[model samples]
Target chain A: SAVISQKPSRDICQRGTSLTIQCQVDSQVTMMFWYRQQPGQSLTLIATANQGSEATYESGFVIDKFPISRPNLTFSTLTVSNMSPEDSSIYLCSVEGGRGSGEQFFGPGTRLTVL
Target chain B: AQSVSQHNHHVILSEAASLELGCNYSYGGTVNLFWYVQYPGQHLQLLLKYFSGDPLVKGIKGFEAEFIKSKFSFNLRKPSVQWSDTAEYFCAVNWGGADGLTFGKGTHLIIQP
Candidate 1:
């Protein structure tokens, strides 16, 4: 297991603005995931960040709207572009220990409110 | 894509009472199941996991879950819950050998002392 930290625990932003959420891990992990959870809703996978390569986005999620960058194994950042009211949610960053059955460690999450 | 469904939206129980949360997934292939607990204002922590070998797995805080492969269900149960057990429980399912998980909507448990 690894310690995951996210910057800006919460933020209030106006519509049409963009915000970047950063996730830092204590150690290197093979797979780093980004998810979005609406208030009282289920978690939705946004993308998988791979070190030294482009991110793999899930269906219905576009790279232009939710761009992800993983410069290395220990760090990744997700930027939400052109925010809207519908974009308000708690964005979480998770790291899996290995491929198959290892437990995942999640960050504290960033609560974003777009008005 | 794999998806999980939690039957209960919220549950309330008195201290020392038994607790069970229903969770079902729609994945035909082999999968890994997990239960996570998130206390108020805290990060999600793993309660238990079922990877292989055993259908019944025990986790921390006296929690256990049975993975019914035939029914595609993994329900969490605690024999006797305490007041401190109040938290949100999420059931997650991961595809075999996959890196990410698909989480249920979550069940809010309130334990009254």
Candidate 2:
């Protein structure tokens, strides 16, 4: 199992501002994913952050709104740009427990509230 | 579009009470099923998973789930729950090794002391 840590466990930001959430893994991983959870909702996949490559985003999500950077295998960052009240959600990062392993391990998540 | 469904929104039970959370998926192909738990103010953790194995699987913290392929369901169960078991549970499904998963709305379990 991999231990993942995220920064800014909770933050309140003003609208139109941007907040970057960082995810660090104790071990190298092939793929890291970003997700969002609105209040009282399930987790939604935002994008797949690949090391040294552009992130693959899911439907209804784009890089311009939520840009991602993965400079290495053990580190990745997701930025929620031009925030709004709708962007007020818990952003989480996750990685597969291992290569070819289906189980996933997730970060504690950054709870961002846009005011 | 492929999706997952969790029927219960919130559940309340006394300590040592039995628990079951229903999950269903809407994909018509081979799939992998998982149950994850999120403790208050914590990250999501895997409770159990089902992937081309015996229908019944056991997991940490005395949690278990049975996969019913015919019904497209993988329901989570714990014979007895503790106050510490109070958390939000999410059901997820991944199709054919896609490396991507779809999640259910999640069920909040409140185990009263």
Candidate 3:
């Protein structure tokens, strides 16, 4: 089991502004995942952040809009650039130990409201 | 891309009533199934997961799920539900190699006391 924490639990931001959400895990992990959940909806995978290379984004998502940074195994940050009302959602971070760990732990999720 | 479908969007039940949530996933090949619960104002917690071995798996909070590969379904069930079980339930699926896990729309459960 891993303990994950996110900064800025809930924030209200204006349109066109960007907000970077931080995720910190207690243990080092090989893969960190970012997910987005719209108002009263299921979660959608945003990207997969590895410690070294670029993040792997889903088809509907792009790197420019949701830039991810994973400088170390225990930490990663996701920035929602040029935010809009449609971007308002709860962003979550999850971690796994890789190699058949099977279990993935999630953070409290950052609720972002765009105006 | 894999997808998950949940049959019910909202379920209302009285305390001590039986609970069952339908979950079906696309892709018949080997897959991992999981049920996650997100209580009011809380993070998503893993209720149970089925990887291999027995198709019938039990998880935390008296929750159990059956993995029926023939039907591509992993339905969650509980014998008796309490008012505390009022929360949103999400069923997720993954192939075990990738980082992305496809999630169902989620079922909003309101257990009346």
Best by lDDT: 3
Ranking by DockQ: 1, 2, 3
Q: Write the per-residue lDDT of candidate 2 for residues A54-86, one digit (tens) a residue.
A: 999999999999999999999999999999999
TM-score of chain A, all candidates: 0.96, 0.97, 0.96
Per-model DockQ: 0.74, 0.71, 0.69
Provide the lDDT at B59 for model 2.
Answer: 89
Candidate 2 per-residue lDDT over residues B1-102, each given as its tens digit: 899999998999999999999999998788888999989877789989888779999989999999999999999999999999999999998787776678
Q: After superposition, how far is residue A14 of candidate 1 from its true place, in Å?
A: 0.9
- Find the 10 residues in a row with the least total lDDT in model 2 chain A: A96-105
lDDT of 1 at B16: 96
Q: Each model's TM-score, in the order given?
A: 0.97, 0.96, 0.97
Off by over 4 Å in 3: none
Model 1 deviation from native, Cα RMSD in Å: 1.0
Model 2 lDDT on a 0 to 1 scale: 0.91
Model 3 CAPRI rating: medium
